[model samples]
Target: MSEKKFQTVQLTLEQSVESRTKLIQGAINRAAHTAGVVSLAGKGVYVIDGLLMKSGVTLDVQAGVTLMGSGNEDKYHHRPGPFELLRNQTPICALIFGNQCDNCVISGKGTISGNYRCFIKANQEQAAHIESHHYPRPEMIYLQDSRNVTVEGLTIIDSPFWTIHLAGCQQVKLANLTINNEVRMPNTDGIDLDRCQYVVVQGCKISTGDDGICLKCTEETKRFGDCTDIEVTDCQIHSQSAAFKVGSSSFGNFLSVKVVRLLIVNSNRGLAFQLRDGGLARNFQFSDVKISTRDFSEEWWGNAEPIYITFVARDHETVIKPDDGIENVQFSNINANSPTGALIYSDVAGRIKNIRFVQTQLWITTEVGKMRHYDLRPSEKRQSLIMPVSGLVGRVKQNQQAGLSVMYRSNEDQPD
Candidate 1:
């Protein structure tokens, strides 16, 4: 059956953050039983707090409007228990929580600003000491367990944490998004697809401090663990961390993920897989990528490797199972300029298997002050290992068949 659309509810509110919060939440409550459109119109910044989405609702942030997220701690709702990234007393939440809402949309040509300036602790970014607000930072958009969601054409800015997080969502599409966070800010990931299935992200221009496009199977979303059948294409991304990555958390299985036509520039790492929590990542294809990486401040993870795929235990004593690995991964038609080459490593034999690189060209940029360490951070005491820079460097366990199909070009003529 077709959706029974309700009349448009145009929100008119005062400048106070509390008023906007009340009005927005009231509109959602009023539309709970039926499908509706909550339109934020006009050409001014509306101080918005936590707004929970409802099913079949569309949040129409109009062309000239802006939703400015309030930084006050008490204005928004938060989780009862502390998250792993937060202090024990700090609360975790999002500015817009689309929890279990199906057929919802957040589409606009306007902007959504997280107003991270109010949350900045100290403006410092260098050598693993980026000053951050460890206290009560919230994500920008947390769409949890929702299906048939579409977020497009919005200019999302200065997110204190992850900008667009689709946690356990199905059949979603994100397109034409312009996301820009402070490049030196910590943990401001552009878009994170956590335990989601059947998602497509295309035509996004994202520049952020952390990973531009990341896939995660975190412990929080363990119940919905099959993060598979996703595609990201035609995106221009830049980040202090990996432009495209899967991890820092891989507790759940991932399969059939494809990323193509990526323009990655000035990122710390071009592509990566940080399988820390020991899950299988397989049947992935990365193609038609133009990547340029440079060494950034040690404050972030990554060390300029154009292709970094590592399957190592997070801790020394943490034992990895025999099947915990990345397998059947292919990289095709990739051209990269970076200070370091690709690093594919696995702690056990056959753990990293069936890798293919076809028409992969590399131009190793000059390494003046860049670190020569393969950093596997969020691990045990020894987080990094000093290594010689080389083209397509890998370290599988001794006597393991690499199962390689290689076409790599070093000293390739780089494009202007």
Candidate 2:
């Protein structure tokens, strides 16, 4: 028997919010049944509550097409549910969401606008952003419990929260995507992979209010196995927080993480391993990264540390397995222009092991000279301490060790 042809449908959107939502939903639902493709074409802005992607479906947002959020809370009641990693509990919404789907792709050189300014509170001039405490702040894109997914070549902008969050997925590939949010929007991480496996992110440029590319193991999704075999490379990242961070939200062990050749444009912090939840990580490697960091505002999470590693429990009430720790992490050929240096600390001794740096150069600029405070945020009660600037600081036990090799510190006074 001959194979049935794949259905290919193209849509032009310029209608009421309700009409456009139904049109796109109908097109996707029909196309998904036939393993087909649905393209959102034309120059008009498409107002959507959400786009539900199913298995065997491809959403090709063509160039010049714009998918804009409706900015109405009631239109978004159709979302599957919250991912629950978000700190905000006001309302859970997403512009594009897929759950339990396989063989799906979202690509093209179009734009997805979150319309984030609508969610920001008015009449506030703080350097850091304060989101609306009472309104729904939806993510731009969220996919969970899916396999064989691919996203590429899209420009995602102005997100009120995390730009793209993939959770509990397998065999995902993200490439050549761009995320540029308002630099002060809170928690608008460019890409967050949670409890995911075999993911590759490459050739992307991200700038946001939080970590540019982050991996986490959330408390709600700890039932999944270790996050393993993830790679991020050839990306340019800038953020008010760390350019690349692994978990201030970790609740599961992470394994085989490789991040390389990232150009951090300007960040508040550069590289960090924040294991406040006691989840261990191993076999993580970072290399050939160039970073620029500066202290921006007190509302953010970091204080310009080029590399910060802390493996500490949140509080006395936090539970930690006896063997829960981070180890076998390495950073090589790192170059940074920042005010502060590396901070290696733990709540107790010997929790962080085998941390190493090779051929790292930190040019401590005099722009923000002599920062006298240390930050241990996302922790319990202990926010910061009055400390002096040093090239490197750490907490090491007598038996266990962390190593440093060929580190160069440069400033005006210290010529050598």
Global lDDT for candidate 2?
Answer: 0.80
Worst 10 residues of 2 by lDDT: 399-408
Per-residue lDDT tens digits of candidate 2, residues 1-416?
23323443444554777777787788788877777778877776777787788887888888988888877756663443334443433336677888887989899899999988778778767646666655346778788889999999999998888889888999999999999899888889999899999999999999898889888987676666668899999999999988998888777888999999989877988988888888888888999998888888888888888888888777766678888887888888888777777788888777887777777777775433355676888888587755667677677543122334223345555422
RMSD of 1: 3.6
lDDT, residue 121, candidate 1: 65
For model 2, how many clashes? Answer: 0
lDDT string for model 1 (15-82, tens) is 46777677778777666666676777678777787888888887778787888888765666565553
Candidate achieving the largest lDDT: 1
Compared with the true structure, all predictions reach lDDT values of 0.80, 0.80
Of candidate 1, the 10-residue stretch with the lowest lDDT total is 399-408
